[model samples]
Target: MTAVLSRGRSDAPVRSVPGRPAPRRRPTVAPTWFLLPALVVYALVVLYPSLAGSVLAFTDRSGFDPGEWVGLANFEKLLRDDAARAALTNTVAVAVVITVVQTTLGLLLALALNSAIRARNLMRTLFFAPMMLSPIIVGLLWQYIYTPGGPLDSTLEGLGLGFLTRSWLGSDGALWAIVASIIWHHVGIVMAIYLAGLQSIPPELTEAAQVDGAGAVRRFWYVTRPLLGQSTTIVIALTLTASFKLFDQMFVMTGGGPGVSTQTLSLVMYQQAFVYGEYGYGTAIALVLTMIVAAVVFVQLSITRRGEHQV
Candidate 1:
């Protein structure tokens, strides 16, 4: 009987049925859906307005009626008019100065903040606090400081440095003053970004370099700077875009200055649209400004991508 049972068990084989099919692949939680709300908002608020502005740029919508098509007339006038040319020149100059100065100062501040120091948090808060305030508020506040015989000048005089003070918001120096205010306002933001990048770096790498006889500057240049490519990309792109789009400070500080010396493309666009009531021309200027920004971003992106490839 035992031999017969064993034979039967052997012949029966391991009749093991498979378990329930793996739970229907708990549907891949796509992150793309997270972007839906933002995409919708952008389409409605930004994309729609930008498209409408482009259309307006092609039409001379002067009165309450439907705008008449004017084709390239606005652009032609923008190029040919001397005032427009001056505005363009001033815009480029201001943007250049703001970008260069802001980026350099921001990097320096970031490096300083990264260094070990007592009261580091307090110093960081103080440096970055200006960024939290509105640009208009910053402008107004700085205006008081820049005014002749104002707090800054008074302080200079009190310190026996009266010769260093000037009419910061008048004449040719007004543009530089405006640029300085903007830099002070924005440097904090860039510094924060740089600080984040700096902190992300592995301390071991830096320590290893130090152990290998690399000095502070050498360690930063070889280890820290090279690793900071992404941070540099972000800072440069943000600074460039912000510089070109600057308006509030300019408006509040100089109102395009003694002779339109600080009239950025944004300020010119505003003046054309609201002040001069040249809606079509203003739209054209806006379109041009958008194109310039896009071009700059594209160039930066291209350079970043190429650098990535080489790496």
Candidate 2:
């Protein structure tokens, strides 16, 4: 009986020793070969085309014949081109204005809807509904709204504010009109980002701040704002990039028009490449735009990441 009991005890699994951690199983890793198919497709589609197009930037190709290499001629011409310079200026201005105004308005809207209020859910849905619509649709809708004697002007005239009504898409205000429409279309996305950030924050933190004699403004400034650093970074990066590459809506509404008043870099590139068949010049412009976007985004990420760490 003693020998049988001892053998059974010896066969039992050993328990972990007190105060010692049990050994952890190594996680199973997928083989790198699993990514080979995707890598092959990406190289064929994206990498090959990008590399080929970039090479064309140095040549004087006109979409038909394989033209000779122009070295830095295209870039030099771009520097001296008045239209290109004006487009660059307008693009930068529009991007900055949209980023600032949209971000501010989105934050405000997020704050308002985040609070416990009647119809907040319905209001959020309504505001975000525009985002679901295609940009072309939004452009067409706003185009009609901005037309003289259209709904906007009619409403203003009915309200006895007829003096305020003018050609919204006129040269004097066409750029701004496009900017407003872009903001209205995209601000809801920014609001959604902020709302997600707000929800992630611990309610205890804000409650404690309130109990410690912090007013609404102070609490938001010190506690709530700092916690939203990540969301703000994401929102700004997205808005900045999107604004820089603005093409579709602007193309639909103004066609870079009222005499280039709202011409963006994208519009210029499109016109040069598709309309005029200046393939090489258009490719150069695209390369420059890509570099600008990459550099700006890098600096922005650095600054925002530093802010996050400080928070």
Candidate 3:
């Protein structure tokens, strides 16, 4: 009987009586209110406008009252419009060219500036100074240089290269001229990014590679380049996004062109919305542009991330 009682006690689950006090509840966590203001502002300013604009893309709303539903007419018009097609192609081409050239030139400049030269600091300052200037200022400055009798023309003429002195911003050479301006204005930012990345690399790694009989090129290929993965990723992503959304320079410089040679998507959107009063079409273009920018950024990040994983 004692054994049976012992066994029962051992196997029995403990149960609280009905009058027993409930276990103390954990203190309720107060949600952080620090992000509230910024979140609210973002929702109001950015998110709401984006959503509203997307909705507007489907309507034939003017500045007047009573907007009518247009369905896919605006998009269909855009597809059939030769001017729109040309503008899109030009935008893509210019963006790609500028991004490639800027990235290369900036990386080269960063490498040069990283050398042990007495004038390195001065050179770095000069190189990065253009980035400090406003886009309008950059545009005006380039416009002057591209004028028929500007410094560039004079310099080329003086060097007996008169053939190279054609009107830089005129129809024949305007596209290349705009691209050149973009590269000049933005390369400094890229250089700074590369410089930062270079600074972050450990000197010991390079030294060790050198000590092991690796040549400069080999060491760079095996060490420096690999280490710069993060920086390259950042540069590419920023440059890609900036290139796709290029606007300010175009606005101030060519105003969509001598002949539509430099009419980017943003320029087109502006013309549609403000110039032609085609608000619906303009909003559709804006939405597509946003999607394109997102896609480019995503692809760049994905490629860089995969490379990083391999490293």
Clashes of each: 0, 0, 0
TM-score of each: 0.86, 0.89, 0.88
RMSD score of candidate 3 (Å): 8.0
Which runs in model 1 stand beyond 4 Å of their true positions? 1-37, 305-311
| Reference-based lDDT, residue 181, model 1 | 83
User: Model 3 has how many clashing residue pairs?
Assistant: 0
Local accuracy of candidate 2 as per-residue lDDT tens digits, 1-311: 11211223434444445566653444436667798899999999999999888998899999797899999999998999899999999989998999899999999999999999999999999989899999999999999999999999999999999999988988678999989999999999999999998888889989999999999999999998988899989999999999889999889998988888988899899999999999999999999998998888889988987766233
Q: Which residue pairs show backbone clashes in model 3?
A: none
* Model 3 worst lDDT window (10 residues): 1-10
Residue 227 displacement in candidate 3 (angstroms): 1.0
Best by lDDT: 2
Ranking by lDDT: 2, 3, 1
Q: lDDT score, residue 86, model 2?
A: 93
Assess each prediction's global lDDT (C-alpha) against the native: 0.82, 0.90, 0.83
lDDT of 3 by residue, 53-127 (tens): 798788887665447899987788888978789888987898789878999999999998998988999999998
- The TM-score between candidate 2 and the true structure equals 0.89
Error of 3 at 288 (Å): 0.7
lDDT of 2: 0.90
